[model samples]
Target: MARRVPRPAGAGAWGRSMGQGLLRKSKIGDNKSTQVDLWGGACMVRQVENVLLVLEYFAERRAPATVAEMTDHFGWPRSSAFNIVSTLAERGYLYEPRARGAYYPTPRWLTMAQAVSEADPVPAALTRVLDRLVDETGETAWIARASGLHVVMLDVRESPQMLRYVARPGMRLPIHVTGSGQALMARMATAEREALLKRIRYQAYNRNSPMEAETVRQQIADSEERGWFMSNSAFSSDLAGVALPIRIDGHAYAVTTAGPENRFVPRMPEIAAAIRGAVAAECGAGALDMTPLRAEA
Candidate 1:
């Protein structure tokens, strides 16, 4: 089994139950623990924690930290400290210069970690809800979140029909052209909404999809009035999407939907209710629900 890093001193022991146990065993896991460290050798949990701390510090902002910084932070023996980091580098979790010993997380680590997190319960729960939506209405389902002046399609389950919504991860669309984006905009403050609009250019990418700044503002007002956002060929020429914001602690993180122009219009009310019900059930009325973020709203 791989060893896990211990929780930091200030973090409540009770709150760190799962994380600390993994540290004791020397492994970090997603759902089921995959034993990456199979040497059956006892690894120092504190050393692992120190390394993870360094990795997190880098992950947050992408600055390379020196060995001195890590050692000062953990107070571990130099040899053990270097070895732990070296092991992580070898496993593609981090990258370090051979001479300088400065370290940063590798793309491989981010990719693997993203895969694990997506498969974990939070996103899994969202996916299950989306799947149920597809089963219930025989339509495409989407879960999207605001990213900059656009909406990022996080996850989607396509309808079984020959012509269905075919969007993938990392797909970003302009906020003005998307129902999901408009729903999020409906809940944002005026300054934030205007700032976002200013940041994104109102360039006409296609002939029928002309969205000026004023038009976008009007759409947001309409969404707020209707309690939902609806678009017929607002994004794609033939596709429509209906969206509602996912709020946790009065902040909007994302929107959930049943879409694809073919099914969105006729099923707007039902899909909107499904999305509302799912968000309410999944997030509840907690202030601390979902991962913390500065740009949640």
Candidate 2:
């Protein structure tokens, strides 16, 4: 028989030690010894933030800026700043004339913004109507659109009085609480109104706020009977308001005027007439095609 070769001394122990070291290293990950360079550690996209910062800097300056000026202002390295400026110039957003020249934002940005602004129909139509309504009523006039179970004030023209009700654009109110909400419900079809009524959460905001469904339904019926809707201390104890429903391009909207209760309640009829006249003048008689509730009766 062949002689058995003797195994190397401590070879098994050495192999075990090497295996354990590898396992420990894998568990700890590469965070300890690896000095990751600037672009290698995090895989997040920071280019968007850099681009926005460049645009904002240009906007604040309102004049052309060279790459060196931008680097100094932003504390960025010269190479990084140059790359950002070059990329922006390559795109249509920035324009430069010479090889080493100042960069300016192109008219493309302004033209895009103007196009977006003009595309929105609400601002153009409601602005003209609210201006005249404010002049005629001398109270805060506003336009509100229905958003789910809430009414959002899209625009407002504040009253020129020392103690007038104040409302800001983008203020959201419960659909069951405000005069605009009631007018919107009144203008809806019967089936749709009933469906929406079920979704409303009836909470008593104040003593005057209608908390019961039956009471709210009665108020909606009353609003439908009249061409407009009114509320006195219903939303706030010291506030009163009147609202008229308007239809534009098959969308339902409400125009409202509100002020301190003592001043607004007495002039409800005048405010209602002013809103109607303003709508007629701005939108034309075709908008008045919605039959008045009394005519149906």
Candidate 3:
């Protein structure tokens, strides 16, 4: 821990590379890492890891935890657990609602988390686009951004239809097969996209799913030509999706409308048009791009 120092104002790729490495070396692989804590146990910084795990425990247990409970939960010595919990209590992150009672996290934790998330919250215009897609197409709509080889749904608007693709924020979808994933990849530089494509583990989510990088590359290529993306690809075998890539401050994100194939497939062209119109109307013409997203090397 003493060996590394903080990155300065102009940190280079080493900083970016370190962050990417943490995401890439997930014990659960590229897909599940973000779905869990942003980088939790995967972070080599041990002290921080313990704190996140403690918070997650409180979250899961949904009950105030005594020091003894913490001890038993983490298998730490009573003194070690007491010290950790005590430190958090002193810092106002944890407290006993009743004296001599179990310790519970304070609102400070939630407020601070909210502050951080809101600092770079999803664009408001994108929210409008998602709502528009739901209104126009009457299907589940989600906005996702590429996270490693998966696209993490940042927000979701469920369809009113009885048989729709029920999705939620924080759902992770395979990068190679999802329409949101394909649109996101299409916005990346060719070399970067190729590198990610090569690393993809193309599972046969369905008999028609692409099984190779070339196939996916061609999909992106076709998407670049079509100006939007659509797929029968699914997290559930019977679902289908349409996605359009948009860039916000140079970051790639996709807004998608998805549902059961029986209903969604027949309306693919209409849905894609709706998505494109919504993006153009709510996000402005500049928000959509066909030029590759290139980060400074």
Give the candidate number with the greatest TM-score.
3
Candidate 3 accuracy as TM-score: 0.67
Deviation from native of the Cα of residue 169 in model 2, angstroms: 1.1
What's the number of clashes in each of the models?
12, 0, 0
RMSD of each: 16.3, 22.8, 10.3
What is the TM-score of each predicted model, taking all chains together?
Answer: 0.54, 0.59, 0.67
Arrange candidates by TM-score, highest first: which order?
3, 2, 1
How would you encode candidate 3's per-residue C-alpha lDDT over 87-166 as one tens digit per residue? 99999999998777599999999999899879979999989988998988998788999888888889878777655565
> Candidate 3 — worst ten consecutive residues by lDDT sum?
11-20
TM-score of structure candidate 2? 0.59
Candidate 1 lDDT over 1-297, as tens digits, reads 234333222211122121101121222211233112211233547645466566644543346767666665556677877787788888887777456878877788668767986663235556776777777667666777776767766776666654455544445676666777777776666777778777666654334454677888887677766767777665445666667766553456455554445556787888777766765666553421332234542
Clashing pairs in 2: none
Off by over 4 Å in 1: 1-111, 114-124, 206-210, 249-251, 258-262, 285-297
Which residue ranges in model 2 land beyond 4 Å of their true spot?
A: 1-119, 291-297
Candidate 1 lDDT for residue 117:
66
What would you estimate as the lDDT of candidate 1? 0.58
Residues 160-216 of candidate 2 have per-residue lDDT tens digits of 765666555555676777889888777666776678779776665556788877888
| Higher-scoring candidate on TM-score, 2 or 3 | 3
